[model samples]
Target chain A: MRKGIPNDPGRRDRLRAVALEFIAERGLRRFTVRGVAERAGVSPGSITYYFTDTDELIMSAFELLTEHAEPNFNVRLRAAGTRDEAIEVLIDYVIDPDDASQQEVRAVRELYSLGSRDPKAAALVRDRLEANARTALMLHFTEPCAHALDALIEGLWTQRSWNDEPLDPGMVRTAIHGLVTAFDSLEGTSA
Target chain B: MRKGIPNDPGRRDRLRAVALEFIAERGLRRFTVRGVAERAGVSPGSITYYFTDTDELIMSAFELLTEHAEPNFNVRLRAAGTRDEAIEVLIDYVIDPDDASQQEVRAVRELYSLGSRDPKAAALVRDRLEANARTALMLHFTEPCAHALDALIEGLWTQRSWNDEPLDPGMVRTAIHGLVTAFDSLEGTSA
Candidate 1:
């Protein structure tokens, strides 16, 4: 068991924020409870008190980062009234290096890596993806189509991680447009 | 240093074969070199002699599994009667479970996890992907399209990893078809 901090809500947020920054900078493999605590100007006990384990801390930190980014997505989606506009926003988000924080990208990569080997971690990612898709305005397609869209988006991110070349916004738009058109055409047909 | 097992090229093959089986049966996180050696009926020294480290062993074993399942993609491309046939083969190969071993999938998941945090490991995967694309029929596309296809494939694989449903052959085929059609259209426009 670890000792508790003063239990300020701000303190917990600050700690998690610092942790997220560290994860993005150092990569998740190198993140440690002690290191996060030190950076946050808190005791190690405070970290353990807020999060029971390393995985818990990592997961929470990830959740925080993603949740923070989610609003931006929502703002974009809401601003786009048509399907094409929505896709354009999505493609822009995906390929625009300036739109994404390096830390956030690194954190997502870490989550993906952890998810591959751990069922619980994988479930976390799956749940988030499903939840995001459900909330997404792009859920106008059938169940299979929606799921396939998810696959395409996830696949795009995986590919993005490996390459150093700047992703072309136009190519992304074309790919998403192609996918949407294909699914729309296949609506009545058995998938 | 680890001792070599003499008089048998089969020994190395057997060890890798068994290693793949073990990985499929048990996730890579739980797999060990000793366990692979034992399953192969070889000594630990033999496993070490062939693979200096677990990462090397895992990577090589995966490379072997991929080669074993699919015809040399590059060779197929060169011998292809038409560009369509080559693209079809590539599509068929990606989604065809018959040609892809469970071990190969596991190895990929493992590599993805490592690549998330390790730049060097990520570079290897990126290089492999670029090499595969270079050797394929996509050289005709503008450099951006060629790279976009790589991202699309990577995203597809990553999505497949997190998906809860069993692999759908038809869906895979549809995705490949869609991708090819989109690329073909790009060619038409460019021409």
Candidate 2:
């Protein structure tokens, strides 16, 4: 079992915040305990004391981001009156992303890649993506429809990060709406 | 500007092959020139001597993978004269992945993450995805339709990596056909 830090929430939060910063600025490739320590204004030993395992620390930091993101999203999703409303809610989230800084988007992408190599991290990523997939599956679309929607959501985010111009929100909505309409007509319950 | 490695293709290929192995086995997180030297059975100096920059080496290895993958993919893609046939070709590549080893999938994902933080690497990744998206766009679909299709293709691949079962080719085909059919109906030249 891993030991806890000095029982200071502030201190613990600081360490996590610093870790996220490292992940954001340098990416997973350069994220290091010493880097977190130096940025946190604490000793490297302090970070190790709080989190015995690096993966645990990484996961903890990620959960913090998720914890911050999911509530409002879930609330909005629940409040959505219709299937179309629910998808619009989802689209808004994707277009804006969870972190206003857009830090999580990059960090999450890094984690997703990290998951490929790190079984534990991969599991965490899978859990989040699967949760999203489940939500989509529950919609009127079939399994493949859900999968395609999920992929389009992720793919657009990725495309935005690379494209010279920032993605036009109207175009994104049009594209997303087109996908939903198309899928609805194909496998929708009413049709 | 990066200096060229030695004029020997064999040495350069060995370095890249070793780098690919490290990327495949450990991923880019632990990928280091020193590590490459140890795995390649060469001194650290030799690694530095051949590749002036680490990023250059990484990019070279990536380009090598691309060169190996794209030609075969393009040939198959060209052979598919019909729009439906082209999507099938796309599906096969994503489903089976380029390398049966599945190493390329993970490696490419890592490069994608790397791209978000590293401008040069991001450019390389963008170029490849853009090229792919362009090919899709040139088909029967409009720009947004093509983007959605491109996104869905990538999204399905990602979802599969996390899903417990192997991606069903039948399910994939069904989902793809649905999306295409939906789009075709929406923007049919006749309609």
Please report the candidate that would top TM-score against the real structure: 2
lDDT of 2 by residue, A2-69 (tens): 46323777888878877876886788788888888888888988888788877777877776655554
Over 4 Å off, model 1: A1-6, A69-71, A137-148, A188-191, B1-80, B87-91, B98-102, B113-119, B137-149, B167-171
lDDT of 2 by residue, B92-171 (tens): 86677544435766777777778877887777777765676457445655665566666676677777777667777865
Clashing pairs in 1: A155-B155, A155-B156, A156-B155
The DockQ of predicted model 1 stands at 0.35
Best of the candidates, lDDT: 2
Q: After superposition, how far is residue A112 of candidate 1 from its true place, in Å?
A: 2.0
Mind listing the fnat for each candidate?
0.39, 0.59
Colliding pairs, model 2:
A151-B155
> Residue by residue across A136-177, what tens digits does model 1's lDDT show?
745455554555556666656666677777666767766676
